[model samples]
Target chain A: MSECIVITSGKGGVGKTTTTANLGVALAQQGHTVAVVDADIGLRNLDVILGLENRIVYDLVHVIEGECRLKQGLIKDKRLDGLSLLPAAQTRDKNAVTPDQMRKLVAELKEHFDYVLVDCPAGIEQGFKNAVAGADKAIIVTTPEVSAIRDADRIIGMVEAAELPEPQLIINRFRAKMVQSGDMMNKEDILEILAIPLLGVVPDHEDIIVSANRGVPVAFDDESLVGEAYRRIGRRLGGEPDVPLLDLTVDDGLWTTIKRWMGLAPAREVAR
Target chain B: MSNPAPARVGGGAPVVVRTLSAQSGADGVIVSVRVDVAFDDVRAELHRVLGQTPERWRNRMARLDLGDRDVELFDVRRLVHLLKGDYGLSVTAVYTTERAVHRYVSRELKLQVFTRDPADDCVQALVGAVGEAGATAVTEVGPHAIDSDGVTEIVSGPAVTVEDTTSFETDDDVVEDDGAIADLSYDDESGAAKAAPEPEPDVVLPVEPMPIRIAGGQRVQSIPRSLRGGQSVRFPGDVVVYGDVNPGAVVEAGGNILVFGALRGLAHAGSHGDEAAVIMAFDLRPTQLRIGGRIAFQGLEDDIPRGPGFRPEIAFVTDERIRIEPWRGRLPTEQVATGDAPPSTKTPGDAAEAAPVTEQ
Candidate 1:
């Protein structure tokens, strides 16, 4: 039984694309056949994030419009086996595809892959609607900001209204040091408003940005904490509910390290 | 464009601009434009000088002090158009010594003109302006308008005139229409007539307060689910919701509004005009609260901070203004006696006190 999940965040720049790319690699690394479909249409980024941008001869639009077969559009990941990408059309508008076409496409992809992950676009527009059309479940992504939470709450309401099962949440770009200092919001604050099940929280780290710039998914690196975070979330999505959350506070160290950076602590001998 | 040779202007004289200085005035600025060039260059040079004003000065009323040059009627018209259209300045009055310009600009453009009298007529208007209310002018604060020891400043230009005597210590907040105030006084008309009254500077038309109306609810609407952003519920009667009202959602009713859960959205009770309408929420952190025509924006961060932590609040009109206080419980059954006072110890305000007999 293949379950297709659409990863969405109503607000842009909240890591919908990054979550889709990393989770796809995480699932593929677990030896499961996965096909991550980019539903952002004109703003297709799953191909770029998965480092499969250059190899696209056909796209989701071509598949939907019957110009090419579904196999012609699926780009295999450069690094991992059993992982493929159905990239959205860069030249076509979002209106080029319909919700029925997406449902049909996902139904076909499910026959070949174990799991199909659809990367949704930002906003509650037509592209968002088309992305949600084919998904069996949804994974909402949000940051610790008020605007992100507000939009997430709105997206959750929309997902329920669309009759999708209670969507799980992934709080991305979390900074533990800021949340610990009482400056930023913690997981409890977001969960209180959203009242949804938590898939995981990806700590804000340089690895994600470095991977994005280098056209590589962070999930390829097993040592990175953020990579582990995505891997845990992937396991949760894969029906392994016992995967524990990663310890994000390991980077925040003690107060001395914080004070030393601020040049406020008393002179302590440098150990290193 | 390569810094053209000292340009020969009117009367075959190659004139050049001398100095330019700006002084901050009430709600705007007063620019003292001193130039040896003729009046034809005032508009062109004004652009070069005041083109990129400070961020605050942009779109504000700017005063320009054009030198005592031969200002024709057409010159005033073009200068007014350029200053208004190009620089976004509201020129209030024009002061000129040319009696003929005084005749035409006042008749054709309807601009006010003033003389450079330091002691007699100028001081009389200053005293009158100071008496017209406790209007706080910059003159009283910095005392920059007038020089003590009874001395007037003769700013060097086409004509030596008292420039500081014009920036008055008068009704600083009075508002007036658009026209430039040129201060070129002639010895012939020094004591001939009164100075054109200072432009009315400060009178922003105050918005009239919305009058609260009296009306009862016709029906009661019950909503079982939470309202998300872009969703709204409007009814002609009271509204009761069983779920949270998320941000960007709206709940409007003609009578009272009660939310069982948090209200992060907007709640407008008394939509028709019931001033006695009250809004009670389990966790009241609405973006805006409206009781009748009165509106109170939840702008203060301390009043309704985002995130979790509930201290149920009830909003009602109590002294012509909507006031919010802690809500203990609702007396929905009318069980309390009419004459009995509300228990002040445990309750800040009960729902019975906020809801009047609107069912007339």
Candidate 2:
């Protein structure tokens, strides 16, 4: 039986779409047929990240309306054989599909696929309801910032109310260096507040931005730290054993040398 | 589809199989097949078809008998396929058997046999049985009853009287023809109309209103500027510093105050205020101190420490007496450079330095 999972976060710009795209690619690489559904509707970006924007002739809305068959609307990934995408319509609003219709569509898709991953929209609204209506499980993405954690807590409450199964948390854009320096909140602090199982952490990396711009998920790039992290997340979801977190500690000598060479380091302010 | 040839025996009287086919165009087909045979042989045949002996077949078949056994087999898969495959016959039917005949036909042979019984129609028979037992057998409701009749009845009497005496008022006035009153009158046998007289006007004597007292304390009006005395004046709450209190002004506050620059004002610690309330200044040169209800004047004998130019200082009641202290302490830069301080406390100093400072 197929398991539908929704990747969501209450706050925007927390890498929900990026996580969705990367996880889809990673799961597909494992030979599981995966379909990534972008439920952001009018503000669709999953297609762009997957680099399949130009190929989207018929979208989710069209398929739901019987204007096109599901097979016709599904965009097969050029890079990954087992991964496909059902892009949201940019012209239509979120109201175009109801939760019941989404449930029906997902039920129909469950017969043919092993995993259906949905990219949920920001905020706990109708779009969120529609995205999670058919999902068997959920993945909540959050940053270590106070506002992001607070919003994630609210989203967790909402998901609980919807009667969905427990949601695992993926801390995104975590700067381990800052966290070590006490400048940012740590993983334990976020998890303690959210009270959810930690899936895997995706460190902040420039390669992610580059890959996203190129419409290729970083998971395909084995050399990238974030790409490896995404792959580990996929494995964990596949019921694999625990994987260690990425060591983000930079060498003190290297950090100091770089700072000294750039003259960007500030002298400690003295007060009496 | 054609029906299979009947099983035959040459010794006994020729058994004629009469097949009655009724094609109710819209309603559906009802075909009946009658066969005459011995009772013992028919029982064995039923056992073979149902895949169980008599005891095991009880749940499968509702009614059974030795001779003239009327088995209402509804849409039997093996029998229907036989009828369609061998004999080109498409019909629904009920079968009635007065006797049993199990003359074995070849394994390859197929027969289309219809039994005239309610059980011949799968859905119809099941529905009919459930209906006969007066049970609502809906697909969705299953065995669970959809509607229940056990309802709770609330025994209600006259409502409890809750008199709102606070809002009640009595009025006395000359009787006037106004429709304001409710019509509580009932018809008399004589058809004569009668009405109750209006109530007398009530006189409400005015009572003295209670004095309004502030919850915390009375607001202290602004102190007169001309009433300047070096004697420390303590307040119960905030002291509003309107003008510059000179170094010898010796003003004290119970809480906090806003001083508009040049706090050369010798504000004493704690006026009528709590002892913990402090005296702050852009420049700290207080001549006297007082906290709560206590007053302490600066003596000539007390030695004061010279600062590396005191920027701002706040003096509060410490050790049960006012003590002046400088506000400077270890800064963020010093902490970061030393690395001895907790790393978490070391945020970029620029962000910390940008924090707004308010004097009150």
Candidate 3:
């Protein structure tokens, strides 16, 4: 059965698009036919992040208006045959396509693809509504900062109002060092405020930025730790409940253990 | 507009066809037609009357008046069908002196019928006003003319003497404006009829002072989700928000406001000058708050201490200034009105009792 999941966040620059792209790649890698829809419209970035921006001859608006066939507008991923990208139109705004139109498109896409991942825009406006309109589930991405957590809370309420099932949270760009030093909010603090199911966390990593800039999703990079996090999230999304949540604490091989033994590093809490 | 004169039909005896306009109690205009001839003559007279009237007044409420005549239901139904189907008039009322015809029209046809010699004067006035031509329907004396004495007697009777010692002056202005003239006047009389349970203000208000919760109880509008930036909801009464009011969002109400979540946005309660209205929220970190004539502007950097923990607070107008108190089943008396009153002799018990009751 096809499942539509919208990746949304009320705050901008919180990695909703990146999460959608990586999740799409990871799901496709598992042999599932996936269609990643960019619901951002005027601020389309999913195409560029998926390295399929140059291949778009027809966009979401064209497909919705019947100017182009759905297959014609779908840009097949260069790396994976099972994966495709429905690019948003750069010329049109969020209001160009309504929630009803988006629902119809998602319903049609569900007939062909096993997974339809909708990349929602930043604000909880028309773009967010369009993305969540047809989704069976939702994934809210947020940072550990107060502002991000607050916005995430607002988004969770909005998603609930849209009648979508309670969304899972993904803490993006988390800094273990800051959390350990009490400089930033810990996972527990964020969890207490959001009070949603935890999907997976992607720690702050430079490789993710580099991969995004290269138009390659971090999920495809085997050597990248962040990519592995995306893989775990994808498996969880694929109904693999046994997949362990990523540990945001520093995981520097034998160094951390040796330092702990030598009393050089502070004792690690094994509460979990 | 003189009542349409009786028109004469050629070949047959002269057919008397008269059309009269009456005003229903509900302010709707009702046109009545009296036919003193056969069914065929009535049709011809109706056509002549319809031709004489303007198009705007054609499809108005029409009533067929059979003055003391025993007409058959079939012929009446046919005439009603002609009025409704052909003339496009909504035949709501049927005036006939026959009791069987009245009962049939009221029951089977489901039309209002007024028989001759209406028992009650009030009912007579109402029925007479509906049947009589000219602007008598708009005279506003139909129900009042009969009920005025009963009302005044009930209002100025024992209840007025045993309770309020002050001279009561009836405010006639309250009688106008709202269409619930009958209900409101009755309520006013009943309110005066009841013995005053507590000492009230000197000026006798037409209506009893209603509790905010009961009077406008269902007027509570709720925003089930967070109001994002640039979004706003304006309600004429109390508002309850289940989600956070985001920084740039706004929620305005004409009465008390309650937020189940954080109030980070601009919230204005008591918008229409109800100073007693209060705004309560789980987290009251609003950017700005306006209650009636008072305004409280709070910034992000403003240091409102929450010592150990933050509790839900209520913002209300106290001594003509905005005061926010940690709502722990009641407003804290220790928490003095900031920027206005110092620690006063009023204890917490006094504050708790004073929160709900406000003197005019």
lDDT (tens digit, per residue) of candidate 1 on B216-265: 43356889988887778986567889998988899987667889898889
TM-score of each: 0.60, 0.43, 0.56
lDDT of 3 by residue, A1-272 (tens): 89999999889999999999999999999989999999999999999899988899999999999999999999999798799999999999999999999999999999999999999999878898899999999999999887887788788878877888989999888776667667877777677557788888787789888988999999999988789889988988887977865554445335467667788855452111
Candidate 3 lDDT over B1-360, as tens digits, reads 233233222223212222222322332333333334567766764555454443533566655555444455556777778767766777776555444344345544677765543222122233334333323222121122222321211111110111222111222432332233334233344346654223222111112222232224456787787675556887656788998787677887666678888787889876544455678898888989987546799965774644557888988876768888888665444333322233145422223224434422
Using DockQ as the measure, what is the rank order of every candidate, best first? 1, 3, 2
Give one digit per residue, the lDDT tens place, for model 2 in A82-144: 899999999998999999999998987777789999999998788999999999999999998
For every model shown, the clashing-pair count is: 18, 26, 0
Of models 2 and 3, which has the larger TM-score? Answer: 3
Task: For candidate 3, give the lDDT of residue A45.
Answer: 96
- In model 2, the runs with Cα more than 4 Å from the true position are A250-272, B1-360
Best DockQ among the predictions, by candidate number:
1
lDDT of 1: 0.66
Q: Give the poorly placed runs of model 3, Cα more than 4 Å off.
A: A91-96, A124-126, A145-157, A188-195, A252-272, B1-269, B274-276, B279-289, B297-321, B326-329, B334-360
